[model samples]
Target: MGKLYVVGIGPGGLEHMTAKAKEAIEKSEVIVGYTKYIDFIEPLIKDKEIVSTGMKGEVERCEKALEIAKEKVVSIVSTGDAGIYGMAGLILEMKKDEEVEIIPGITASSSAASVLGSPLMHDNCNISLSDLMTPYELIKKRVELASEGDFVISLYNPRSHGRPHYLRECIDIIKKYRKGNTPVGVVKNALRDGQEISLFTLENFDDSIVDMFSIVIVGNSGSYIKDGKFVTPRGYSL
Candidate 1:
């Protein structure tokens, strides 16, 4: 039987690609991913066959990769950590008769949080604002609950075409349970080229600045900005 490596390529840069991930890609005869992600690794994979897909075609892409892997060694690539809102879940769901190996990489949330200090040091939850598969009401409910529980939130897929208002709604919901002065940080294309970081308060979150590539971190009431970095004290060193 052929082997399959489900690899995470990190956020964007070639430097971020883990050695194991690169080795897996090099050993594989087929590399599969979204077009944007595939483009990021194009230079590394010169002789391999690339199978890429458009947006919202994750399942189809994975299925195609699996079919090809049955005959040839294949590597399915995802940006950031494969387990966190990445291709890990889909690949697992699609794997029935095949044995797959997952090679992990840095998650965007982790990278973003590291750059902005430590907003996730305390109790925190990661939420995705994209409602393509989930209903808006459900997303709102999750945000509301997380806010009421005083959990810092790391939001993914915060903004995109035809879904510009979701992030604003998330901010509004969190504001109702938390203070208007709560710290919020936006990290765009974290750890990648043209990376940008923006800090603001819950009351002043700039909706105009967010995009699909951005990750928005909303801190709890205990969170604060120190020297331009947003931090939530973990109480470990207190």
Candidate 2:
């Protein structure tokens, strides 16, 4: 009669995690997550049974957690908010009448937004460039629509060695609706070791520096950079 807790650890650091997420992990006798995400919370679960898998093993990891939760309190972790591109949905989808609790934490988009100032103050949409689970054509369409709507856009899984040009292609699609001067914020390893934040314009953005560890925010038409801070005006009279 053990329960499952799906937890979001947040931005590769303990400080970024929520109290409920921490408590869930502490209460679990078995912890599960991707290899790197597991590393982020290694100190907390050192004494607990850890189950980790590398990339593309998400289904396997979730299945393992379901099995273990039958006998032990199990906590499966995701890097960002569990519901946002995290493990919570998958676990819920695969379970049958199992008691499950979702513990949310800061998502990468919000973490990156905070580091870059306030690019997300206005209407925004998050779109992942990775086509592994989604088709590239659909992803491109979403990017185009987000740009057309003038919503601040956050791009996740922007680039990697396997798909080096995906980010560039997405930028080109965004260019169709956004001006070259629109502000863009790129954050690498946000709130984590070796964090880097850069502010630039859509036309001059250096996509070469972006990788899997990066999150890119493309501002709406009204967004701007002032005093080295990237911000989107919420239309409030000041």
Candidate 3:
């Protein structure tokens, strides 16, 4: 039986991709991933067999990858880090004692943080606002708790056309624990083409600027904005 590799391609850029991730894809006979993610590495895996699916076909995609792995080496790719909001978890949960390797890459939170200065230099947590697999109520509770704990927060899947007001609702919960001037950074398409980085305050943030492609970083109470950058200090003496 051939081995299966779950790899993180990282921000859709070859520069951001780890060497191991590239090696995994290069060695695999087949490449499987979301359609957009597959397009990101299209040049690299041009000669390999590609099995891609659309938005909600995650389960079907993984199942196909696992089945293909039984006879040939397969690399299942995920954008950003596969472990974080990617396919690593699902692949592991579904595989049964199969020889599987997980290759980690830069996560979106860190990619966005690099563009927005050091907003994640201190303690931080990532929360997804998408309610397809998880309940919105639970997500709200998590946002509130993270806010109360003063953890620098990275929000994934902030908003979509179907759930337009979810981000606004999360911002309201965050406002209850964080100050109006707390630094908020929005990075769209981080490390990828047409990247846009914007800094805002918790109170003045424009939800309209956010979308499924953006990663929102909400600074903790100690976070600040300076010289057009958002920063969450690590509390070291000057």
Candidate 4:
């Protein structure tokens, strides 16, 4: 029996790929992933058999990968951290009797935080607003709780053409706990092609430029900006 490897290849480019991730893909007899992510590492796995699925075909992709793993070494490719909005959990759930290995990668929040300053220096939680799997009310409740907890928040799938007012809706929920002037940072396509970062306050945040590929970071009460970088201090006495 061959092995199953769930690999997170990081953002869209090969530049941020880890050695382990590369090895998993390279060692695979078959590579399976969403079509766009498959395209990113297409060159590296050109010799291997490729299986591509559409955006809404996550379960199908994982099942196909698992079936392939029964007879051949298979790698299930994902963008960002496989555990974070990736294929790892779905694969695990379907692996009722099969063994699988999960290889982590750089999640979008951390990558965007690196581009912005140290906004995640303290406690934080990442919330995705896509509402594809999660309920909108539940996401709103999480956002409110994170704000009440004073957690530096990283929001994935913030805004999109499909959900034009989701960002505004989130901001409305956040303001109930955080100050209007709280620092906020937005990074689009982090560590990938055409990356853009926007630093602003919660009140003046511009959601117009955000899309499905963007990541948004909102600081806690103590967070601030310095030297043109977003900084969320850790409350050190020194």
Candidate 5:
């Protein structure tokens, strides 16, 4: 039996890539991941066996990595924190009798929040709008509840080409609980090349500006913008 390391690369930046994550891949005999994630760490994985799969091939990739790890150490890479929408869960679920290690990296919400402002200072929840595995109704309910609870929301997989309306629908539901002027921050390609960040309001944010790669941080009722920064104060004055 061999060891399997589930690593998160953290938004494609070498600096954002944790040292442990890099070391896991460096020490591994095989690296398995989606093509994009594999390429993100291509520089550190020279001469290593890379088994990259295409989109929606996570299960195949993880299984293949585990099979290879049967004799040699393997590293399976995910984009953000391995536990948060990464390969950690799948790998653990599929771990029949192998030593599975999860090396977490900073998740998108945390990194994006840093880039945008202090929108996640208080109670917050990170929700993905992908709807690939999660039902849309359930996602909507989560959004509504998060909104009603006055928790800041970090939305992942907000707007894809096929699911363009998901982000808009989610924002609409959130607006029912939040004021129309509620602060919203959009961070695209966070911390990666071609990064973009912008601030908008609940009623004015155009869905066209976002894509699958974007993370939208919608502020709670008490959230506000200070000096062009989106901020959700943590009772500092109370």
Candidate 6:
């Protein structure tokens, strides 16, 4: 029976690749991933069979990877952590065989938060603004609940060409339950080249400056900016 390893390659740097992930990639006979992600790990995979897909088509991509996995040891690569808004979910949904191994990597939100201190030190929830599969109404509802419950939110797929105003709409929903002075942080391409971190308040967030490469984190009412870092007290110190 062939085995499949779903590896998270980290954001976009070779140094970020975990030892386990690199070992898996090196041992695998076949590698599958989006073209960009494939490029990120190309240096590590010199002679491995590679199959890459364009953006979108995640379900189809997983299906094809699984089909190949049934024949040989295959690795499906995802940027950042595999479990968080990565290929793991799609792979699990299409997986009939339970013999797959999941290798984790640093998620962009956590990495971004690290660069800005610990924004998720307290309770937090992650929401993707993309409505490719889910309904926009549901996304709005989740954002509203996250705000009302005072949970710090890490937003993924905050903006794209198809949904230009998605992040703006999310900010509006959040403001309905939180104050205008609520702290928000934007991290673009975290841990990768061209990385940018910006600190701002909910009232002053500029949607035009954000894109799909960025992760937007909105702090709760109790969250604050200290020493140029966004943080939420976990009550452990209290």
TM-score of each: 0.95, 0.98, 0.98, 0.97, 0.97, 0.95
**Model 4 regions lying over 4 Å from their true place:** none
Report backbone clashes per prediction.
0, 0, 0, 0, 0, 0
Which of the numbered candidates is closest to the native, going by highest TM-score? 3
lDDT of 3 by residue, 111-218 (tens): 999999999999999999999989999999999999999999999999999999999999999999988999999999999998999898988899999999999999
lDDT of 6 at 67: 94
What is the Cα-based lDDT of residue 209 in candidate 5? 94
Ranking by TM-score: 3, 2, 5, 4, 1, 6
* Candidate 2 accuracy as lDDT: 0.92
**Candidate 6 on 1-238: residue-level lDDT in tens?**
7788999989879998899999889889999999999998888887999898998868878998899888799999999988988899889888997468999998888888988788998889999999987899999999988889989999999998999988898899888988888889999999888999999999888888899999999998888898988888888755
The lDDT per prediction is 0.90, 0.92, 0.94, 0.91, 0.91, 0.89
True-structure RMSD, every candidate? 1.3, 0.9, 0.7, 1.0, 1.0, 1.5
What clash pairs does model 4 have? none
Pairs of residues clashing in candidate 6: none
Relative to the true structure, candidate 5 reaches a TM of 0.97
Residue 190's lDDT in candidate 3:
97
What lDDT does model 4 reach?
0.91
Please write out the lDDT profile of model 1 over residues 1-238, one tens digit for every residue.
Answer: 7878999999879998899999999999999999999999989998889899998899998899889878889999999988888888888888888779999998888889988999999888888888887898999999999999999999999998889888888888898888888899999999988899999999888989999889999999899989988989888764
Error of 5 at 208 (Å): 0.7
User: lDDT winner among the candidates?
Assistant: 3
- Score candidate 2 by TM-score against the native: 0.98
RMSD of 3: 0.7
